[model samples]
Target: MGNDKKSELEQWLEALCSDPFSSILDETVFRVDVFETETEYIVESELINCTKEQIFVTCENDALIIQVHENENINKQRVVHLPFPLLNKNIRAYFTSPILEIHISKEISANHPNRYMITIHEIDL
Candidate 1:
């Protein structure tokens, strides 16, 4: 069952990255980090030109921690713990700063493929 879930997640991620919307911000600079543990994985992303835009983070089977920082100051922090097993869950964190930080953690099964993905969308000011 765990392997199946992971496979589904991988497929979803592939499709997401293949989508035309995924490459819409190629001109912008973004940073993505994927960290893996024995039973969990962490994904962190820092996006530029994200002020006044809603940042979305998704995971398959764990909790989400989002922190917003501006000018080296912490603006807002939110943690969401999901109950049910996530096939694909989307959580949005709003930021009004020039720089935005997003962190996501999810449980990873040994039988499942380990991967993380980050997507950014530009919102109208």
Candidate 2:
């Protein structure tokens, strides 16, 4: 009780209860960049302050769900499981500012060539 005799609201409640998870420890997951070239398959997300109706992109089973309605009591989801399976009617999305570029279109892009980088791995049966 002796931090200069406390009470500035008890030193702001001792600096907000001294980190009880530090406000959920920042970063509620939103940072992605799954690259590829020669024919597309690029999904980027930064979404500063977010918009485009609070953002929402989907592709289900072959994964690529990046939702962020941010209200109605906070709901921010992210998932990007794609090892192959893109070109759901040739996708394309762009949102300049803080980036949100998704341009997937490669079902067999003439048998892949330039840059060719699409590797997603996660296995845990």
Candidate 3:
């Protein structure tokens, strides 16, 4: 692509057709990392300028959903899909400033999916 500027029509079209978060965020601002260990799954997310109270996390079915609610209209959401199913119990989440880490125990999930909210605790680094 060239350095040419997009026309007004193109800009408007892009704005209208963009995804929910694409128009309001740079995507790179909220980076998410997901990995698996022998016994557990780990999800680390970069949530800058966010308060622990404003962040909501939930493990449902095969995905862990991370959401940062800046306000009613502006919010950031990311979903980390687990390689294998996980049970909500034995999950530990520690948040220190811009980094949020979630350690989820690997368990054979139930046939009926369950959704559980994860409480984030602040830890002194």
Q: Give one digit per residue, the lDDT tens place, for model 2 in 69-112.
A: 86753467666666555434356676665677777776544333
Q: List the residue pairs that clash in candidate 1.
A: none
Give the Å shift of residue 23 in candidate 1: 1.6
Q: Which 10 successive residues of model 2 have the least lDDT summed?
A: 114-123
Per-residue lDDT of model 3, residues 94-114, tens digit only: 899999999876664333347
Best by lDDT: 3
TM of each candidate vs. truth: 0.33, 0.26, 0.66
Q: Which is the winner by TM-score between candidate 2 and candidate 3? A: 3
Q: What's the CA RMSD of model 1 in angstroms?
A: 11.9
Off by over 4 Å in 3: 1-29, 72-74, 107-113
lDDT by residue (14-106, candidate 1, tens digit) is 664575643452233343333444544444455554454345443435545444456666554443333435334332333334444342235
Candidate 2: which stretches are off by over 4 Å?
1-27, 31-44, 49-79, 86-95, 113-125
Clashing pairs in model 3, backbone N/Cα/C closer than 3 A: none
Candidate ranking under lDDT, highest first, comes to 3, 2, 1
